[model samples]
Target: MAEIAVVAISVAKPGHEELLREALEGIVGPTRKEAGVLQYDLHRDVQEPRRFVFVERWESQDALAAHAQSAHIQAYKKAAADWIEHAEIRVVSKIA
Candidate 1:
């Protein structure tokens, strides 16, 4: 089966960019060490400093589901909830 690809985007509320970034960054190390993580990268928008993105690849749907329920992920979500202006997450497959 093809790896699962996920793109998660978040925009920080004004004045909370740094906090949001910190919250997002806190998950990288732990996530990278997860059982089925093929790749997990975080990026900040060059033109829009307040925006953050995570590009991730998982071995399967179950892996992704496990990731979503991870303690770190839940903590990040809770910590950044008030600081986020908008959020979007997409799961896709690479066909190219």
Candidate 2:
């Protein structure tokens, strides 16, 4: 199976940037240690400080599914939900 890549963008509510950032950062360490996690990176938009992005690569669909069900991810969702004004997530395949 080919690898899976995920691009997730989160926009924090006004005055909630730091809180959302902390919640997002908290998942990095554990996610990197998960099985089949080729890459799991978090980025903050330079021009838009309230925007956060996650660039992730997984070994397979199963791996990606596992990641979605991870305890840390669940926690992040709970912690960031209220602070997030909106979110966009895309899963893609590498054609190159």
Candidate 3:
């Protein structure tokens, strides 16, 4: 099966940029250690400080499903609920 790539974009609520970034950063270490994680990277927008993105690759759809249900991800959702203003997640497969 082909690998799955995910791009997750998050925007922090006005004054909560720092808190959102910290919360997002906290999950990186643990997420990378997951069974089917191939790559996991976090990036901040140069022009928009409150915007953050996650670039991730997983071995398969099942792996990605597991990631979604992981405890750390669940915790992050709860922790950043009030701090985040918007979030968009996309999963795609490479064509070439």
Clashes of each: 0, 0, 0
| Cα RMSD of predicted structure 1 | 0.8
* TM-score of predicted structure 3: 0.98
Best by lDDT: 3
The digit string of per-residue lDDT tens for model 2 on 20-52 reads 999999999999999999999999999999999
lDDT of 1 by residue, 7-72 (tens): 999999999999998888889999999999999999999999999999999999899999999999
Show model 1 residue runs off by greater than 4 Å. none
Query: What C-alpha lDDT do the candidate models reach, one value each?
Result: 0.94, 0.94, 0.96
Scored against the true structure, residue 76 in model 2 reaches a CA lDDT of 84
Order the numbered candidates by TM-score, best leading.
Answer: 3, 2, 1
- Give residue 14's error in model 3 in angstroms: 0.7
Any idea how many clashes model 2 has? 0
Q: Model 1's lDDT to the true fold?
A: 0.94
TM for every model, in the order presented, reads 0.96, 0.97, 0.98
RMSDs, each prediction?
0.8, 0.7, 0.6
State residue 11's C-alpha deviation in candidate 1, in Å: 0.4
